[model samples]
Target: MTLSRLACLLLAAAPLALSAPARAQAQGQPQGQASPAPGRTLRVAPHADLRTLDPVFASIVITRMHGLMIYETLFAWDSKLRPHPQMVESFSTSEDGLTWSFRLREGLRFHDGQPVTARDVIASLKRWMGRDTVGGKLAEYTAALEASDDRGFSLKLKRPTGMVPFALGSAVGQIPAIMRESDAATDPMKPVTDTIGSGPFRFNRAEWRSGARVVYDRNADYRPRAEPADGLAGGRVVKLDRVEWVIMPDPATAAAALQTGEIDIWEQPGQDLIPVIGRSREVRVERYSSLPNQAMLRPNHLYPPFNDPRARLALAYATDQADFLAAGFGDERWWKRCGSYFVCGGPNGTEAGAAGYAKPDLDTARRLLAESGYKGETLVLTSSYDIAHIGRMAEVAGEALRKIGMNVDVQFADWGTVTTRQANRGPVDQGGWNLFVTTASGATMQSPITNIGTNMACARAWAGWPCDEEAERLRNAVAEARDEAGRMAATEALHRRLAEMQPYRVLGQYDQPYARRANISGVLEAPVMVFWNIEKR
Candidate 1:
């Protein structure tokens, strides 16, 4: 899943105090050492590489989850995606809902043994929203967020945005620990050095060139909430004194490591291995679908052909989700023909989508394409060339669309570039191609709070193509609504518009498969992986 982290953040680790490590588990030897130690280092062979270790910027799968043990979030969501307050004790907002005041739990400290203060929180957030820094989501609505004192902080928004705190659940809202904004302004974070954060584990070293495997050790000053991270994650402690995040590009290799007991955990398992891996009594498959945010196929609304609803609808109509799902994924398991912008149980959850979204009707698709003014012109689909499966899925989706009469052309490229191009796309102003696939994932979020105006209406053209004026207006209403109910209604209304418009053909969610030894315990399963909530068997 892709994660966006605000830069110049905090990370974990404390070499100041060290007691002999205790075995996190009573049953077996420590994860990596011959003699068990509570702080003993554990090794892991994961499917994806760690993107970065900059506390404010590294929000990728391995990095963010690993960082959780190092950095802390104001709030966390459990397996059921429920909120669990962490750093802040109890929080409240002004009547206008534009000013949020947070009362933090006292006596909290960073891994460095530094007292966590309102000053620190204020510093971290301001730096995050200051620019296009990493680990930031509230850059738009935020006008000022300051520390009233050591134990209190207040945030003033440009307008009433209900999703404010909820946005904190995202990767940006999650990391780099805390740092003074003044300090960062003078010496900005570098892409080369490892970052800092406040979590159970602290950064040891990050050598991305070493295959993206990062090593971290328990923070000597670290502490855990006796309460579980969520209902899905029961009581847990930072198990295995140390952690070795080994990079294994091949899913098969990672799976083999799990079978051989070379690695105690596997974060992402290949789709083909899902069925067979679960069959092994030696290993258990914890199916983690929707691990990332929803995977959306956004429209290239700026271009000529896509500027018309008939053309956009034709593309949607031409899409054979069944074939695409089957080719990209062996099973029809995780893929959802969703009508709304969110998942079934997300903040925007409702029964509205079930009645609206369904499988394709080729006859209708063919008719739409015909009416959309297509003289069998070649349509290009831009996608990620890496991640073997997604590249394959893009190809399969391209082919499937052709069956319904789309002169589909597939372009494999980095997703970042593709998404930007697609969002700003419009009209027949000639370019290398047409239609780019955009994907969003990593954490659950409330839209009215997280997304900005630039991202609201297909690159701000609100009137043309699949995104109509109603969506634009509703987005505005959702942003300005003073009450939660009003904002939610607006959010739902806009989501409904997305379904009705069917901007891009929905692909599906990225489901992650986690595997652990039979005796292992404390598996924190949720959209985001919280490693501190894990313990050895």
Candidate 2:
């Protein structure tokens, strides 16, 4: 019902959307060539605008997409989810497993024509280890990360940590993107203005217009590995001469552009318009994300009502996943009812603590609210109207929270606004939020070590900042586990604690697909949609 109202609002808002010509100009396309020759230039309409240039600074999917285009990592995950060396030519670990030595591939050069060195890699690793979840765990055991030579580096740990290689190859959440030594030293909290890396594509800084358009040109100097491309690893052969990411906030406008061949690929087609696009012979719709994304309702643990674990558990128990999924995806086929906080079929995925996760009992919720003495506290629930999926989830969840007797204040803002606002840790009255809905790529939730949200490290924890010593202990145990059985046991314990704490309500896992013209090819069906190896012909 809320989405129906939002639809009418969207139609009224269409006129305000950016036009093709204006978008083309913003992307630095010539006046006459509103639609560039398809094969040479691949025009894309991403789901959101490229807000941040620095990949390590923000873990948002949009920013990560940009980072993947312009930067290269030392290691990457293959299609089979195995870690492989990307920038590194070879590596070895001591028998004790405390020291890891890595040698860089020869002739790795940044966009500015400077050669990539071990110092750059060391600096980047240090910065990323301070921010990323897996890297943070590695940092706990790391005694030193230093350059062994101009082309090699070494990481000495206090004890054996089997996760070092995996951490270096991590693909989600503040990815360990290698940058220039100077840019690597830039504060992780601040955005790096420069976009220089030894990736397949080079950022056209002169053409970037934040919320309007961003452009990248193929890097002819980039040296790909001899191995064939597999997922995020191996050779990233750039077939297109240029890639243009045009920002169109309205799905209707983006669909129209795609239908007219104005854009080659629609990174995320709105669910409401899928049927319309499917009817077109020129356009084809398909799922792109390798793993389903799980939308979550994160409750701020710093504020009233939600400050209590009982209140958190009560909200999680009361909420229904179907309501939110239906509102966001529109079709039942696009979503799965997974009560799991981890990826449903992933390594650590299980239904152990999920029995009551999706079983909504409003009576129980109200009683728990009474027990917790939630005295009419205003829960400021914010939603991102800019992204259709997130907006619908937030609206649906806001209604559900109201049904469970929450004093809900539903605020709709752009994704950028929501991202900025959700970071405020102050009181709700002082511009902080009590509840917000966001989704994680299945890659991020593969295991407890990779799932930043599940880590209950309080002051250093993600968004909601749920601090539970027992949860942290369980997570550490899983990280340090020597075998699969031990890992599963620790994960089960962690999941049980997560259920009780309910820091973030795992709404459900849903498939968000992309659309492309029949001629477009080489689109990788990976967790983070990549533009490399894509051919327009």
Candidate 3:
């Protein structure tokens, strides 16, 4: 069905309303205290539901957004992609740069009222380092992470490198969110159910409904940074007394809510509905980040067909970036055809080895498939039904693969289920997936070390587990390069190798704008949507 027709159908349906009991539970009114002012609450229609609260466990954007509402990081990235101190009061590196010392800002406290300390920071970093791509790179250089006092901690590196702050401050991929030591002590593979954090808001777990809404109240005792908000850095002053995530999976329902002022912000509006939403003077659609979102086609590397490089190359040859972009995003103004493994127009964007597969070639794809000795194995393609663009991308991919004489099975599920099922490494009959479509912000694709898609660390690589010794060596070279020229050269080489290996297919890139009520102000332009520093005036 067309998105416009879907929007029309959904808009005709009556809007969903939040239950009164849920609101009362969210507010948690005390006996003697007066109710909060009407305008003090900010209701947001997020792109997806908040299923995974632990950011360390899953890399989903909704989970990361939830973590940002309550969790605080040691450092944060600014608009220029530079790292700055967020939780740290003071920090310095030794002359040789092998030792780094940091002291926590005074008055930092978790939602439970416990003081933030070096122990919490150490534990959080250790946990984050195990899962995140950039954090894993940082772990390779670390010798010891020790706490000197209640508020001070030091990281002793085995070798001097300049990526310490970047890893901790990364706004892309898995965020390095600091949690209480006890919560951080949970296994990295396991989800931490505790919601306690030291950020400007507190997660109201009592009011959370799985598919309906998630609530957060402002942390009254929270402290803000002195600097003004820039990107995800600086002060996180919460002007709103309460922030509620009213989950609206339907774009038309969310767009209508924004028009009626029932929802303060709609995080991601469908490209086709932008014109409809813009017709209302009460709502304004604005692109929040300068970086576009890059779409990827990832294949399971542990399975039979994709495990062979020739089969992977056949998939890439069959893919046409223009078709995927047009199918996923209807409007050309909102999307672009980019073949760069690293995002096009980014710092390290390049087309070193993209010439061969710049356009679709059915003959080459069939020839490669025949060479790979594939005996018509059914490729299971998993996609999310809730996310429109992702589901469209999967459909386009399935069509392309079938044209190349490959058996395809497209499976549709909710975003949470898709994310969970993609982690399995077994065969398709055993709950494993052969292919899926996903996306990453342009900021995350800017560097070889930061981009999880390019990781080839064998068992430790991203979900696909694409492993190559030469790709790993090139990635290390880019990370260890001291000068810009050296870094660029190493990056180009790595990009070339990646194009040959076909770890994942780059479909295209596009910018998605956020629609908000006109009265909403102080929305910071970061790679990810952040709720702090926003005023619902």
C-alpha RMSD values across all candidates: 9.6, 2.9, 2.7
Cα error of candidate 2 at position 353, Å:
1.7
lDDT per residue for candidate 3 within 1-537, as digits (tens), equals: 565785575467424433345434433534355546759988898888888889877777889889888998899999878899999899999999899999999999988889999999999999998988888888888999999999999999998888888888987778899999999988998889989999989998877778878889988999899899999999898888988888778777777767778789999888888888788888889987888889999998887788988899998899988888888888899899888878888888887988899888999999998898888988899998688889998999999999999999999999999998977878898899999998888888877878888888877778888999999889888878899999999989988999999999888899989999999998998878898888877
lDDT of 2 by residue, 414-521 (tens): 788787787688987788999998888888887888887787788667778888989888888887889989889988988888888886888888888899999998
Query: How many pairs of residues collide in each model?
Result: 41, 0, 0
Q: Rank the candidates by lDDT, best first.
A: 3, 2, 1
Candidate 3 worst ten-residue window by lDDT? 14-23
Candidate 1 vs candidate 2, TM-score winner: 2
lDDT of 3 at 420: 88
TM-score for each of the candidates: 0.73, 0.94, 0.95
Instruction: Tell me how candidate 2 scores on lDDT.
Output: 0.83
lDDT comparing candidate 3 with the true structure:
0.86
The residue ranges of model 3 lying beyond 4 angstroms of the native Cα positions read 1-11, 14-36
> For model 1, what is the error of residue 427's alpha carbon versus the real structure, in angstroms, after optimal superposition?
13
